[model samples]
Target: MTSTAASRPGAEHNGFTGRYLLLLVALIWPAQLLSVTGLLAGNAQSQIAVHFHTTQIAWFVLVSSLIGAFLTPFVMRAADLFGKRRVMIVLTVLGVIGDLVSALAPNFAVLLLGRGVAGFYAPIAALVFAIARDVFPPRLVGPASGLIGGGVGLVALFGPFLSGWLLDGHGWRSAMWFLAAASAASLVLLMTVVPESPVRQERTPMDWAGGLLLGGGVSAIVYGVGRGSDWGWSSAGFLASVIGGAVAIIAFVVVEGRVAHPLYELSMLSRRRVWSVFLATALLAGTVLSAGTISQLLGLMPKIPAVSDGLGFSATKLAWIGAPASVVIILTAVATGWLARRVDSRYLLATAALFAAVGYGLTAHFHHTVPQLMTVGIVSAIGLGMIVALVPVMVIEVVSPAEQARANGLQNMLQGTLLTVVTQLFFVMMARDGRVVQGTQFYLDAGFTNAFRLAAGFAVAGLLAVALVPKLKRLEEAETGEAAR
Candidate 1:
């Protein structure tokens, strides 16, 4: 697929019917909904803590992410070997099971296990991207990718409000049942409507060692970071986990370089554009996740006497305020897909970084009222929408069709890993020496303020990464000219 050939509109070779594409999008929607529901439900942290114990709430929220980060690479490879459809069915089944377990759990440990099972759904985005690239015509690729990427943000827009309403009216377990039913519906749709992709590679030896090392390493590091504040940062266990994780990662890299059929291609990281995007992705993931966690905390904070102290809004009201930003995310993502055809992607990324930086910076300083917070969210979401739309497309642009699934899978892994660490750090920042306010049942305003400032710094770092991405014109020209020949 040459750039010119891929970019040409209405070229019908290997194109999917509209219904096929719609079914694929439909199958993807539930996965997106499940992921966002967890984030939105973070607003109920206080309630969850009361039920499960304060020490376990963070684990409950992060367990799914941690499992997802480890499992993504293996799942992508499975799709490559067995089939995308088969893998998706397996994932959906696991999601349904997880949701049921979560809804019925009597203890925090059971809920944690259930959440881990739910992690199977997290990497569906990468598989969806691969399916789009394989089945859709080049012309439709951008739009398809946009929908896959933006779909999450779109659902996430309403996710908070929906979760809030359920929490307020039906309780948290009802939210679990809702997700379970959604997953089951998606499973039915996938089996009945979605077609198997024609793309397949010869079965190769699975990289079990690579998978274990990477997964274990990432889990260790995340656990260390998550528990550091509670265990004392300088404790032996914290130092051991962090160091062991670093060593394991180094070994994984070395082993990958030596393996014939490695789980992930380490060489891809050597490419300037590829590695730059990965870095930017890590920073973007960290910033976005941190900001979101902080926003939830802020929403849950009690209305204090001082205006600058807290908003004191109910979960439902907070959802309504933040809901508009989700709409903005969908709109901006669609626009981003359209814009990528005309504009340089590097320029698009740089602009996105700027929007994020400005949004976070302003929010850090001016979060005194609902309107102000909503405005900040909208601006940040615009940038987030662009990032969500463009990153996967750019990743596709850099790799061949056969490599798309793994590349996207690796991207998800990196994003999840960084997001986990960043979110844990934010929790640490918010919890450090903090007391629960009597009426608010949340942390002081100072913790949120500090966390937002740190989030802005991550955005600034992403800006620098985007700045380093070389101009895309030459690469585009080379791809087009290659096809012409």
Candidate 2:
């Protein structure tokens, strides 16, 4: 729609028909499709690994997610400064172009770069939420946000099966083609049907200084971590990257403190309640991401007792068998949403942490059969679902209304940051522990052993962080954070 036909401040009062409602639903499908499953290449990991002739398969997820984690705040802030429609359209174009780059790449470098570009999908959901608030009435905004936020349930339910068909039947490139095609369709609908949001916030200059510091710091650190297995851990190159990145982060915090419109509001970190959310988010979110990758890796093992005993399934069978857990997770998320309203969120977090700990810890020792692994997955899925649902709840209950958006943005930033660390950490362990057999890299039984043990440890640490969380002051009347609003 053109600006002349665009929505205005009071246009939300203008009632919509089923036509507009369908448009909103259309907008949500791609947002969920790309943002949640974009970097999740586990379904195609074995093929991509063998095709690229490298076990640094972690980079497939790490680099894309690192790019997303480091840059999402700036992108979301850009949406707020410029316009949502223009920014969302730009991100969609970037995704399509990125997919094309990834699909046709001749080497890993080009594909990695393409995946990084595709990270633009991460901030699209936040923009979707803002657009809904601008376009819908108050009565409908809640349902719209709920639909967009938790709608991942339905996606999760079918995502594995769909990936199994596409990746197994056509090849890994088919998956990229699917995302690109879906994103392209979403882009056309978004441009033709979704009008620009007229709602405005306090207009401020973009915080390029803070963005550069944070981005540069994160790039250096992740570069160091991702390469640590290749570069000796104590090597000067690794030391320089880690030390330099830490210094840059310190500089970012100082710069943010002085800047009028900080990219990441540093003062919020001073609050105990808020920092606890961040700390827990960092640890628990990492474990959550690691779980999917761990399961995929487990599925590919050869199932030799005492040497390597795992499901020994192809990616297709892995996806089909894992479908049961996805169903449980979706159901648990629904139940969690209901429970969050009635229970103390910290109790939820602590309970989730324990469940995750037990599930991962037990799987470290006993992963023999499909039934055994399925039980472990179902147990962990419950905890993972609760943590996924409650992290936002904890953010709202802990942060004051004034700083809620920044808190949420920073929370997302922290989640991505820790996820990168955990993924790199696991791969590093695998590299260190695995063996080369007949020119093929094999992750030994010991590697999976240590990785699951480490995951359990991280969950326990998250539980400690949960203990420190206290109910924060809230303006129940004020708007909650944008992810759910």
Candidate 3:
């Protein structure tokens, strides 16, 4: 006979139940929407540049991506120490406040500050993954996590179109206003529906030194890479930032090894399989970020006056091209989760990398028409969807439940750092040798092609790393046994 609901060991906890997994997935949408607000406003580059310097456009994108990355480890640690639900609510509220700040900002600096504040929302996905592992049944974990992965793509399907509509109707600020309202609504639902995690790590003092060193190191390195083309690769500032950042990172590693209750366990890095996954994930992260950025730039770039360099599509037209790819991402992510139950995850991951490589290759060489671009996008989305759905499950399989949040956080940190570096490289490549047309404010066709090629190279690297992933049947069986007990 089936056991009664009350008989379930952890069912009585007031936390988000299995029935509410969809709500948890829904809560993540606002953050995803808010994160891409800058991308949605790509058509307004000239208008924004009129108010702020052209360089600030890059800063606007960089700040949001970097700040959230630097804060993810801390936020994940907080979620582990405090409660995931509590921390999520706080972050969501902050996201709302950030949207409002951006919406009402009188100047570019204040808007950047607002975007930086919104960066806190970046780790919400890790928190949700942790919650799914804690709250859902073992059988449901993959599907639940898949939904979280897919939800991002699902929202992307609509976000651009909606933002474009709003931008065309009102103004650039209208998108921010929409983000604020959406974030507020999501915040309310999160508070009312999601329950606090029952599990909490014992409180430990915050690792201020580690945080500072790591943040400074990452920031310095990213800055160097980002500005290397503009300032000259051999410039004194570039040398100082890169070299200093490297030293700081080494020191940070040494510190992590020595600290009790460290931000991340050094021993985890020693495992070949684990490290391989991390490396592969980092490459995949770079691929996704670079590809997405290139796609947006290509979509918004005006056609060359004498040459067929760009499609010169409106934001709405670009959204329609992107929307189908988003749907494919969602579907593929969900399918990957279903497949993981039967197939080895490493193969799935490797396939993901392969898809990315092919997609980027196609875009680099043959993207002249809208249909070609859309085809490439769909191909890349498949790979991205698989990576998103599988990586969390793979991490969970390898680590104990207690360490899941930190593991995911560390994964995010690595991915974010790599993405920052890769994005800088993309900017450098695109901006090389007067790639931007004077006064037209659009990139040369070669810029987009070179960036896409770079993305393909990263995907190839990811494939190599994924190939090193040890077969996890033994590990999976062991975890399954432990869960059965």
Per-residue alpha-carbon lDDT of candidate 1 for residues 297-339, written as tens digits (9 for 90 to 100): 6776555554324566777887888888889988998898888
lDDT of 2: 0.70
lDDT per residue as tens, model 3, 107-134: 8899888878877776776787776666
Better of 1 and 3 by TM-score: 1
TM-score of 2: 0.87
- The candidate maximizing lDDT is 1
**The 10-residue segment with the lowest total lDDT in model 2:** 1-10
The global C-alpha lDDT for each of the candidates, from Candidate 1 onward, is 0.74, 0.70, 0.72
Model 3 lDDT, full chain set: 0.72
In model 1, what is the error at residue 49, expressed in angstroms?
A: 1.3
lDDT of 2 by residue, 117-225 (tens): 8887666755665566556654454345444545565666677768778866888888878877887888888888777665444668999988888877877888898
TM-score of 3: 0.89
Per-candidate TM vs. native? 0.90, 0.87, 0.89
| Candidate 2, superposed: residue stretches over 4 Å from native | 1-31, 34-40, 126-149, 192-199, 301-310, 398-405, 437-440, 473-485
**lDDT at residue 107 of model 3 (Cα atoms):** 87
Looking at model 3, residue 466 earns an lDDT score of 86
How much is 280 displaced in model 2, in angstroms? 1.7
